[model samples]
Target: MTRTTGYEPLFTLKPVAPEIWVVDGPILKFYGLPFPTRMVVVRLTDGGLWLHSPIQMDDGLLQALAALGPVQHLMAPNWIHYAFVPDWQRAFPKAQTWAAPGVQERAGSRGLALRVDHQITDHAPDAWAGQVDQLVVPGSPVHREAVFFHRASKTLILTDLIENFEAANLPVWLIPLAWAAGTLDPDGKAPIDMRQTFRKGREAARGAIETMLSWEPERLIMAHGRWYETGAMAELNRAFRWVLR
Candidate 1:
């Protein structure tokens, strides 16, 4: 049930670049399925912190993040990824909360009075425009995930788009399920269900991939499982081949 985060020293920042870091958090069970959590922290050019899909936070984690910089933006990268945004907002009341499409509706469905300050588009907002780029992958109504690429670090950030669950980290029973869902490491891609959403018109997904490749990413960060430390372009192509084809 544990090890979903996969990285060590849970809830602590792991430096990826001078301006970028990752925090692997505790496992969260979704509909009886145990899923590890992760978040991307980016320090904008002006020194404000942009949190992408923030994980659960505690006092120690808050103090550690405070040391990084001012938490200016709390981003809900996708609809379901906003669970802990309220916690972060409560801590840093001044931080602006941005959400991807459908997040507000998802929150309402769950009876959560989530505050969404702005809706993300395919382009980065002026807040971090030159620092980060965003793309809204089309062809799916339900899985309208807006992905990001950090220009300074050449790090591409994805949510459930590509889940690479390591066998060693997954539970004994989850190993097969991960494999069946095409989320196992070394050959991971978008889950079968998500891929299906783009089946009707994958050209949009392929276009998104083309744009991502144009960024010449050096590494990749995913919310679940192991993220790539290098060869991000190849992995990006390999992981989204189902939709690209």
Candidate 2:
């Protein structure tokens, strides 16, 4: 199965911890879209599958997932990340849909019908029964963020919280902005918009960051930037220092 349309797959299977795989694509350069957003695939204990943040579905990606096992669960970590849910649900109709709290209402406002099998809350960790650990990053209505950790991989997965851009992929005009925002390299800069978004709940946001940092992830996967393999927890702490203060 190969659905090659809007974008080509530039697959990088990051060994964040162990069984977890971080699949991502080439960066969408023109508009500061660094890396084709990442999607986390977890191999469940039952040999079933659980997917977090389903990227745009293509036959190729779909086939790749099928090879893993039965995709029993599809999740929308937050409101802004639901664009590809319809296609994924169509592809795996038997898969149960899960959404972060408020996601259904948000989807309804967007005129997208969502069949959510469950809604994630602060207690999602217990609800998920150690299969996955979820935390609510309190900030941004558009984001209403949910961060995930795959116990099998010891990997922490996040969307939009940290974006690390590749210099070559950025347009000349956006390069300076990217550099300043900390998307360029090891300096650990948060994107300007991300900075603004984090300001909404300084204390709450910091607490969330602290909670994730406490997990001590071996690798960090971001939706819009490069994935960090080493010292990921340190990088995350550096990038979010502003919120800490």
Candidate 3:
């Protein structure tokens, strides 16, 4: 983890795979849970940039992103991850913002005005012409929870679906929950919360997992936990066994 000091809240940039970076900020403690939040950056073939679940933008981070390339697309893969879109849009006015289906409606309920250039659907892969692959992980009240795979880097990007936090970092009360949920590394298994989340739409979630597994990605980049560098598909299978069960 490359740490950035002198910032009010420190942010770390870690490269999960080639041309794929995971930017992690301070721990967000809410709902009696402390989880590391992250954002992903992918460099596209056309010299354009695609950001997945952008973290809170500061002048430093914004300048760092601008130096990389012109951001052409900003994606909010799930409704819960929409908090930073407005700030990102304001920073990169030229970029086209995208939200998953029903995101705008959900955002409105939260008193947020999300101006999306496009709403993501199953056909989005075809629309982007294989530039990115998106799979909707069905479950949880939070709709539009799509997992993304960037073709250029063969990196599967996820948010909230599979978390792999180290046990030492968690509070004592949370440790048991993390252990029960299979979130504790190195053999981090999918937690009970994730299973419960999947129970609501087992069929749809299974289908989405099956579709994503077919990609045979070598690396898995996650938003709230440690990324998998090798045998990513196998890890994914192990984490989401509730679908198979």
lDDT of each: 0.88, 0.71, 0.74
What digit string (tens of lDDT, one per residue) describes model 2 on residues 1-245? 43221223445444445567767754333343444567788887777777888876666667777777888888898776777788889888998888887788888998998888877766653335686788888866555778887666668888767767665555567678778776675554556776787566678788888888888787787776566777777888788878875
TM-score of each: 0.97, 0.83, 0.85
| True-vs-predicted CA distance for residue 19, candidate 3, Å | 2.9
Q: Write the per-residue lDDT of candidate 3 for residues 128-205, one digit (tens) a residue.
A: 567778867765554447788877677788876777887666667877877777788775655566567666778878
Q: Could you tell me which residue pairs clash in candidate 2? A: 27-35, 182-189
Candidate 2 residue spans exceeding 4 A from truth: 1-17, 26-35, 125-128, 180-182, 188-190
- TM-score of model number 3: 0.85
Tell me the lDDT of model 2 at 4. Answer: 24
Best by TM-score: 1
Measured by lDDT, the strongest candidate is 1
- For residues 1-245, write the lDDT of model 1, one tens digit per residue: 33434577888889998899999989888879988899999998888999999999877888888897999998897878999888888888999998989999998999888899999888788899888999888888788888999988899999999999999988799899999999999899888988888877688788888999999999999998989999998998899888666
Reference-based lDDT, residue 201, model 2: 65
Q: What is the lDDT of residue 116 in candidate 2?
A: 89
* Candidate 3 colliding pairs: 181-190, 181-191, 182-189
